[model samples]
Target: MSFPDFAKVIAALPSDDAEWGPRNTAPEGVPAILNNAPYAPYSKGDKLGRMADWTTDSSKDGRDGQRGGRQAYNRNFRDQQVYGAGASSLFSLQHAEDEATFSVVDNQRTSTKTRGGFGRGGGTVFRGGRGGRGGQVTARGGRGGAQGGRGGRGGRDDRYGGGRGGRGGRRFGWRDFDKPQRLRDASVNIKPDWKLLEEIDFSRLSKLNLETDEGEDVESYGSLYYYDKQYDKITPKGPEKRLQISERAYYNPTTSEDPVIQQLAERDEATIFATDQILSMLMCAPRSVNPWDILILRQGNKVFLDKREGAGFEFVSVNENAIDPPMDPTDGNKESINAPQALSLEATFINLNFAHQVVSESEERKFSFENENPFYNPSEETEPLASKGYKYRRFDLSVSEEEPVHIIVRTEVDAVIKSPVGKGDQFMTIKALNEFDDKAQGAGGAPNWRDKLVSQKGAVIATEMKNNSCKLARWATQAILAKADLMKIGFVSRANPKDAGKHVILGVSGYKPREFANQMNLNLANGWGIVRTIVDMCRNMSDGKYVLVKDPNKTVLRLYEVPFNTFDEDLEAREPVAEEDEE
Candidate 1:
């Protein structure tokens, strides 16, 4: 009664037809299989967990179920081959309608459900949201959100702004993950009492457009030396000419600090004042990605657009709007030499010297303006004055018969070139584009200047137009502001990619300012509209100092009401501390 004899039991069972094993029956013409019935190949190592498993159907548990089934079976029997797996797609179910046509409706309201906090109904604190890269937090909900029904007790709201399409989780834009998150500090410190009057994004600024007539010259100062045609003849061919550093005096004063603009403001020549540099920055702001601040000082009816002592606007940016812009100097990165800051400095130096070196310094060849240089002092300045001319121009920005707005901008001319068509001497604005390393990150896929500047010049220029859109736009704007007949762009690149110290000139290309603006799709009307909008904002406000700051991470401009003594106090505070440190 314990057990049956193994040999007797095996002998008694039918040897030809075993019930638990492969059948021995064969079809008439079948070569592979012994059984006439359909057969599935089995491996010795296959995990035969169940004779009939039912949970693997995708319809039963959704797509997750199919994934789980694959995971479970694959993990246990990875080496085991399944028969008829190739034709398994034939058994899969087909949908009656396209999946793309279907949509999901999320009707979740703003979560006003309160949390534990010190408030009438507990308060909800929002730590971060879209465009909050710098760890900015907002406290909402609780008693305050009760009326809005978008936060607080019994209200359905998200931590971020809640609406039908509230972004509740991490928000990403096109290819946002390719670059590291950046948090930039403001140009000027923000005091607790400063009030934010306006916050405008690039979208709004880009949409603004207003046509204005050519500005009339109010006054002119300084002198412009004739541009030497010899430099233009040089090509980026066999032997490259090294870019020489010149020791010449060049004046680049800010708007509010300029005595000429101050005098114009005092005389009430215009309701608004700005320098070409600052004006160009505001005009080309929609294309910029770097952080910059423009100081708006209002006295009675006049508003002046100015810059800080050493603003980022002073230096020309390189590949700022590229998908992967030049990174900051990190600890161990060797390519940090091509960092945005370093490139800007090198480009700035190249421009300063290129303008001076290209122009003929002869007094006889130079053309004098209506007045002498306002900022230049012959005795105080040891270096010879670089060729430059400034013109104070005024444009009308009146909306209707009642409101007449005028803005005076001090525009600069680098030099003058003889008209190619023989229509007298033509005014010109000179700027140089420097190449750091074409192979470097954030090079914006630019070609090697030495190789391409001579043959594939159009390709080089097109790439530059894409990579340095903001910088080129600013230059063109400045040229137009000055009413320059020609805009000269010089191609300059480092002698060696690894060495940022030395550079060489490739060649020069010239284009009319108006024509160049059109090529870059730079809408002067939009720029004028931006100026008018900002002027209107200041004109409506009480007379005070205001600062317009560009958000680094996002395309936004925020205007803050600053105390009259904010920057002055900061300078004063630093002076004493600096003196003490010196002691």
Candidate 2:
């Protein structure tokens, strides 16, 4: 209990030599089982720490401090020796395989380096051979150090040590060179039995030009109604003015199906016959992105241009040349109802309804052509006929008077407006551009029509010219063929941004056909030249059916001689089924 008792207790304890005596020695009566294994001793200098110290790594040492790499050692106990440091090698496993060959993937990018002035001290060397130490630099260039080479006073060296102002051995614009090319599918399948006749690219077709005079009218059919000026007075903002759904009878018979074209072919009137739609596509082939095909049927000597039932050419493509065009349902994109295919069908539907709804479809105000509607039958058809006028025009494609080569085309006019002189009417062609979703991908940077149509109609039309270049070009070409005085473009958008079922008209803009052609850089002579070239190719062939298809992947057109029954199955499938009258 006192100091004297504590001193006696400490003096009675064992000395240091005895406490540090052989640990391999067995206790008083126990057998020495571990005597041959040798004692693994610890140092007295080692400090007592936690049972399991996890914060131990070479990189954690103060001198080797590296962030985010390893656990840091405690500075207080850093100098103390570890208890098992000497015996660690005895417990470690040694295998014959080398572990250094293993690879590890790291995604961290290096920090950007600051640009330094030339002839100054070189930057830090991270990886590479070192340059000549304190030697005069050669005129060619100085060799790069570990990180990359440095520019000298004599010449500018590249990062890869390229000679004198050279781009390091690295390639420039590699992104474009390495980008994958898109492979698109053809609009029509080429059967194995088909024969290849020729392949014509846009580059070669654009070089050919032929100046031809304005075509002369052969005959006219169908009737057109006066345009109702009240429709143009609608406000070009908001959903207050919505498009009306007007059901009317409209016909789209192919060139061969036209009774007049067949009669002309029988009479040997000309060497070639085509519709305005087909002719315009051929003429403006160089500007097209979507693929199309025209069926060429050559009988004895005359050639007829026709299209398959439900062909892609029936609909106009929106933003066909956009950097990121609309994707199809199968392309893995969220297939909104407003996909390219759907938008095209919607555009076609809009044009048909817009033309019919804007016209005063009255029996008394209608103007009849030279002949009655060729495809319309009042007795069989129930719906009122739409306002459309068909004019058959003949163009001379002869190089000389001795060899006269003529082609006839069927063009259509949508509506008629009173002339400025108040004597006659001025024919017009009506077309519409529909917007699905401006915020959606592949919109081609189109502005909201409802917001900009009233204030900036010219800007809106210019955007359409850029995104729908091929479609607008075809429309202009058709108007030119019909010799129309004005071309009208209607801006239409969805009534609801997310809904594709309903749409409303935003505004209407009109331009003279010739002036619009000039603004769009549409060359009629170039188009005629393309038509003549194709006609010449088919003129010498034997009597059969030929298909001229635009290559989907490249800017080229290929002519193939297909069997006469190539598209017969589709036609048979499309036959209308009679419906029972509802109560």
Candidate 3:
């Protein structure tokens, strides 16, 4: 049904007046407020009707459900005519009367206040107290002995003359403290053309594919249904499917004829042997790996693995340079040239399964070298080469739990060439190991190794600031000064001449005045006076005659000493020379 027709049915329902109550049970046709209206003056004690008992058979035997019984009146039908006419008319009349009376009083009071006139009596003004008057007091003219003096011209009229004139009251200007005038300008009216605004077509705008003159392509519009269907259809036929198939075939070949198939078979056998070797080595001797020795090679370098006469092997190499000595006889001996010089190296070692194939076939063949002389002897050999240093010097490797490799390198100064390969220049002795051996424990002893693995996988060295090198230096300096009983003031020295003598200079035993000025560029930029100032401050405080001035606002303490007049000339007379030469 239409909405209006449904609403009309709702409006026609019978109201509360149709029920039998005091108002409805009033005498039907009686006039003159008579007929002893029985329902009038209604009270709770009045008997209306007998209560029904649901436990009796009248309700349960289906007799109550028949026609012309109580069920007839209980039908879902309402008589609107019996109650609608009087109830609506009486409410409307009373509401109209209340509105009419309220409007008259409200209008009258609004008119009175808006006119700015007070009712009947007017305002009044009152005058205040008068001005003060001055009066003279005179004692009785003399005594009887001085009667003549008492009558002397009525005491020459010594009474005060009159009161001073009252000052006029202040009068204020009417314009003072007046509110600014308000201009009567019209408000701006901006009427929008609502018809020009387009109605939003959400369905068309949100469509995944829009049909233009171009051909069909992948739709980029954000439609969940379209994306889901497109992904479902494309995924299985994509590149990932090919990758999975290839990986499975490479790991588990179907036939031994395939090269990959043979490799897989060999790899499985090799893995078993390698595991046994690692276990045997670990059990052979209780050994510890040094973390510092496990160095990460820098970019553009190579590692060479050298085989010893026995099964024990070591890795080393000269990276990005010639291993043999230079041809020039005057260039110095080989040991002198390679005297424990710091060189960055890079290297990588991977299992055959993970290693990339070498492009050159000849190089690959060279890499596959092997010796099978199991009963080989070494005593029947030519002259043995003198032991100059470690056969293998540097090693770089990455070790994991699944494939652990032990690495150890001698960092001590004597580990390099022990004998002088050169006459004048003795071969520098690179130490093999030092006393701090316990501090060289590797990753197994590291407390944060697990955290480092999760958060910073390949970061071997902690950041510079994390090492606290500078902080430790400062702390050590302060400790030395404290132990020496010297005043410790935490002040940053300035590089300017004007800031000299403002901060204390410590550890100035071998500090040259010229070097300080040159390093700071104070001679050409600021002046040589900064050097003089620093020297004077240092000399005066050398005898421990200085006062500590504490800053009230901060924790810093400033040490001050008396200035010396001859300090400037003394620094100026010094000659310019290299600081290292002076040392």
lDDT of each: 0.75, 0.74, 0.20
Quote the positional error of residue 244 for candidate 3 in Å: 54
Lowest summed-lDDT stretch of 10 residues in model 2?
Answer: 165-174
Pairs of colliding residues, candidate 3: 412-430, 412-431, 412-432, 413-429, 413-430, 413-431, 414-430, 414-431, 415-430
Highest TM-score: give the candidate number. Answer: 1
- lDDT by residue (tens digit), candidate 3, 1-583: 4677546535544467645333432233323353333332323343333333222232222322223323223334223112122122222212223332353334321111121111112111011111111112222221111111111112110111111121211111223255233221111111232111112122321222211121111111100000011112222122321100011001111121223213423433211111111111111111111001110111112111111111121111111111121112223322222211211110111111111111111322221103211122346534321111111111112223474322221111110111234532111111000011001111111112222323442231122112222221222222221121111111111122132112111110111223322332221111112112222333333332222222222322233332222123444555444454688
Error of 3 at 387 (Å): 28
User: Number of the top candidate by lDDT?
Assistant: 1
| Candidate 2 per-residue C-alpha lDDT over 301-420 given as tens digits, one digit per residue, 9 for 90 to 100 | 899999876556888788897655676756644756767788888888888888887888788888889899999999999998889999999999997899899999999999999987
Order of quality (lDDT): 1, 2, 3
The residue-by-residue lDDT of candidate 1 on 1-583, one tens digit each, is 1144434334443565325443456423333333454444444465444353332442333322244344244556665424333223334565555555678898753433334432333344344322211113323323322112233232222222321111221121424575466666655666789999999989999988888988999999999899889888889775777888999888888788899888888888888999999999999999998889899998888888888875668888888877556777662235767877788888899999999988888976789998999989998899888888999999988888697888999999999888868999999999999888765666765667777687778878987888889999999999998898999999888889899989888898999999999999999999999998987898899999999989867899999998887678657878988999989
What is the TM-score of each predicted model, taking all chains together?
0.70, 0.69, 0.12
Whole-model lDDT, model 1: 0.75
Residue 31 Cα positional deviation in candidate 3, in Å, after optimal superposition:
55
Model 2 Cα displacement at 322 (Å)? 1.9
RMSD of each: 21.3, 20.5, 43.7
Compared with the true structure, model 3 gives a TM-score of 0.12
Model 2 TM-score (2 dp)? 0.69
